[model samples]
Target: MTACLLPASTTLASVPIRFVEPGEDGSLEGLGDTECAYLEATGFKPTAGRIALLPDESGKLSRVLFGLGPSGATDRNGLLPGKLADLLPAGTYRFENDPDDGALAVLSFALGRYRFDAYKAGRADGQGKDGGDDVRLIVPDWIDAEDVERIAAGISLARDLINTPSNDMGPAELEAAARQLAERHGAAVAVTEGDDLLEAGFPMIHAVGRASHRAPRLIDITWGDPSALKLTLVGKGVCFDTGGLDIKPAAGMLMMKKDMGGAACVLGLASMVMAAKLPVRLRVLVPAVENAVGGNAFRPGDILRSRKGVTVEIGNTDAEGRLVLADALALADEEHPDLLIDMATLTGAARVALGPDLAAFFSRDEALAVEISRQSHAVQDPVWQLPLWQPYEKMLESKAADINNAGSGPFAGAITAGLFLARFVEKSTSWAHFDAYCWNRSSAPGRPEGGEAQAIRALYALIRNRYAA
Candidate 1:
């Protein structure tokens, strides 16, 4: 399915078209004579997120009509058209006119081409084949096609990574994925593996990932000149979290494979930045691991030393995401980069507060928080600002160690987790933490269920707005 911002004079070129609406006979004002009669014959009603096809006298589809929920309620219903991309006959179609938000049209249309066909047999219809539809967007002469393509590809990459199951994707797989990205962007790459993690001063990362048969490693990819503004991204790379010694129920472990969603998101964001060739020294740090139970598993109550030289008392073995992230975040902080951002699926408290669709972001810098909120909302990659809440710092204090890996109480779980990470950053560097659910529990018009890149688009937008100039 292709997307285009066109003028009203532009014709449908005989492609099947549908007018979307909220009810029957709603907003018939825009219908042409041929469109009206076709709608009647198809029994088309304007149902939100519903599509009705209009066929011609020769039985060929003429056009598609979609219904808007309500006239002016800030409803972002454009993505609904994406459903038609795979379901309808393959052909070029154009938006009658430019939408108020063109990005939605551009992103959703491109995303509609997504298909999780790794091991599955080919569809008899052959709709989504190699590389999906060769879609084209008809943008205004003023719009930059390169910009649109960069963003669309970034979103598609994230969706593809998220859709792949854990069995097929793990720490080793994530490194391979990162290596591919670095090769494409002409970036430098380095990795510290298994026992090497301890020798390299990433003990926390090693401790958490030691149980898995797949050895854990720290992935580093750098691009651009040393003198350029420095930006570092640390993503939680838990390939699968089985809750270690504090074993979770079978149901809780079902989606543990997607624990690496954070890594996938940053890779997606990095693709956009590098594809756009943003002028900055970019560094991506991911400590890839699988929190599995074994004879040598790090158990609760064990004290571990972090890269930052602080002692971390394990309050809960299940709280392993932050441990791997702590070492990676500490490494990023050592550079004192202009900006540091870490993304993770660290706590269930955040999901209780904002649900799965919105990521909770924490930052000491008010300006950065505001800008992140603005850009994310603008692009529909929703994120909400949560407080660092200095008072929560006390929850992490420990008697034996400098801090507890988990908070003292259940309240403010997300904030406390953020606080635990903050301890590693001695310098008050401009850092933002994204507590995001990288998985979408259910499918939507443009967003499919499975692994997802939450807050990635907004973060990329914010970075471009700030540094890309």
Candidate 2:
């Protein structure tokens, strides 16, 4: 989605988009008698999703009346104003009066205009000149224009990546995307691919992706001063998951293209950090792979040695995301980073527990957990903390190997998966794991129905505040 915002410096004779709550239209002083009568005659009430286009005596567009619903309306989405992007005819418009949340107002307006039009091709990569490009929003001085644009661009990149089909976004293509992002920020990246992963002690990563023609690889990205505090992010990049030997049913495989949502979202957050020039040493590790079934595919019941020297018994080949994340998390933990965070679409149980909007997170540090919750609510980027339930750790015990890749029971599936990854994260100062569902089930306000970047906004806010110079 292009940032559909005019530069804050724009001084053009633009039309004002006035906001009105229920029964507040009479207080609007700018409207003349004819316009007031027109509003009453038309029965235009400021209810949610309603917009009024007011024309002047010359019959030209002059103003807009946007609805805000009741003051404490339960379902009043903060991004509700985003509807204006599509509702209004192509023209330059400005919010005459600042809304209660100006930041969210502007951000939603830009994102509301998002469209995954790369393959369809009105705007390549959802950027450049759009058919709706003329629908420009005037950026007010109270909101940071550059910050909002950076965020919108980052999120749009993630959506574009996740929306792409696996045929065009396999392991190698994912690496190319990572490299492109690194190049843009002048960051350095290294990749260990194919059998080299076995030599590099990333056996689990190698085993999961060995069957695919697009050889699996680990992509590492680093930026900022070496002496600065280290923040490491590890993402499970299973570009397409067919569930390997225990292949998913036809219905289950429908949206497997977004199995690498963790990678896309981490890169989105990384983009924001680089663009804003945040003060910290950043490292992103993505185990890019495709979990496919073939003659060479790793089978259930196979025991694999991981980078951390822990052995895992594969009880289910479908549980492949955590296998790749294990090796990368172990490598990340080796540096004992100030903060270590790993994101993955590791379990459906997470989605069942928190639904699609709230990201389910597990953290070892109490303070970090509290701060993340606080930041999440403050920014309206919701996340709910799920405990690192110690008792559930026993469910992953393996008589064949040191641990089992899949838990013995279905109960506490999300918690047990976090337990599996936790075995390799012994050295990091603080660690958190997020199980996110990166696709939206339906369109609403600023959030569209396709691939969505979850929890990164809240994570960015926490990182920015915690590591500020």
Candidate 3:
């Protein structure tokens, strides 16, 4: 694998160094004569991610210097390291006078080093074609290297799932992904499918996915001790949304294959938790289905009974992500787990309010919300908080049923959707819902312009700290 991560032990000696900024006045506080001359010899000016090779007195090639942009670590820094991965002559190097957080720093380098070659036949034109040695990062040696590798691997797993097209990643494919992960971790998995969904009390999940040839299924994977703090994660796994009878335009359907991004995300988070061996009893519920336009497809305005025993009137067949989630969330709620989190690509409204880069998180608990925010920001996996406005509950009122799947009118769509899902959680004091846009529209350093993982990094941090401590 040409794009694999280089463990942090490689040497990057003789590389020139400079922080990229508007002015060239910042001094290298403590450097030897050789290092200082190399900097001057290279005429290194601060340009974001610009690498210049230094030379020795004997004229031998020396170290390289990379420009750090303004605001230091806070500047749109995701792909800064990635630039080095592609540009640097494959050699090991360590950051000098870096931040105290080794995990974040090391992870950033790994992310910068990420390359998506799955679809690439060969190196593209105008790209740096270095058959150089892998860049080895040098940490302070106090950090848990194994843990860092595990989390990075987990994020990669989520990325791989989301990056895959829907044709190859349907309901059955999702189950296989979960099963493989379970087998690796020594966990147990149970799958309920087809008519068994109705028999098992997941009528809403069954109704939404019944039209597709791929049988609708619910994946239940369990790990950890029975007495540990119980945590349940439910993800909306709409493999592809043809929008059912309501039908979306061809453009709308173009990326519907990424509809299961939420499921992919939670699976990623679950993988991190299990791989790290966090001290929490974890349960993952994914209701995998394809909302197709079959003759047997459930129509608009139909009343469907949910696992929570509440009747929901379908206002828009296109708003099908929340239906599968409702059933899965109810099942998760029944256990009254200490913490419940659900992730989905549930609304365009969320993207409209917060944009595609950030996920919108909704929760009734204030402290948990604050902590989640802190953790997300700390890892640069930011999430914006959306209110669960109680008044909007009236918007989902159904004349023929207990509730409507969608809100009245177009305003506050994200909040109203959150309120709808909030109604199903009978228990669980701390719950959070992340309306994520799992797809990226453009490519950046570590993050490619494809299926993306939102908020999982921050949530994973919060979970490990909350339960293990």
Backbone clashes under 3 angstroms, per model: 21, 0, 14
- How good is model 1 by TM-score? 0.90
Q: How far does residue 414 in candidate 3 sit from its true spot (Å)?
A: 0.7
Residue 222, candidate 3: Cα error in Å is 0.2
lDDT of each: 0.78, 0.88, 0.81
Task: Write down the worst ten-residue block by lDDT for model 1.
Answer: 1-10
lDDT per residue for candidate 1 within 42-115, as digits (tens), equals 78666565566665566666666655456555654656655555555666565554544555665665666555
The runs of at least 3 residues in candidate 3 whose Cα sits more than 4 Å from the true structure, single-residue gaps closed, are 1-43, 57-61, 71-79, 99-101, 122-140
Winner by TM-score: 2
Tens digit of per-residue lDDT, candidate 3, span 313-360 = 999998898899999999898889999999999999999999999899
Better of 2 and 3 by TM-score: 2
Q: What tens digits encode model 2's per-residue C-alpha lDDT throughout 269-366?
A: 99999998999999999999999889999999999999999999999999999999999999999899999999888899998999998899998898
Q: Name the Cα RMSD for model 3.
A: 3.9
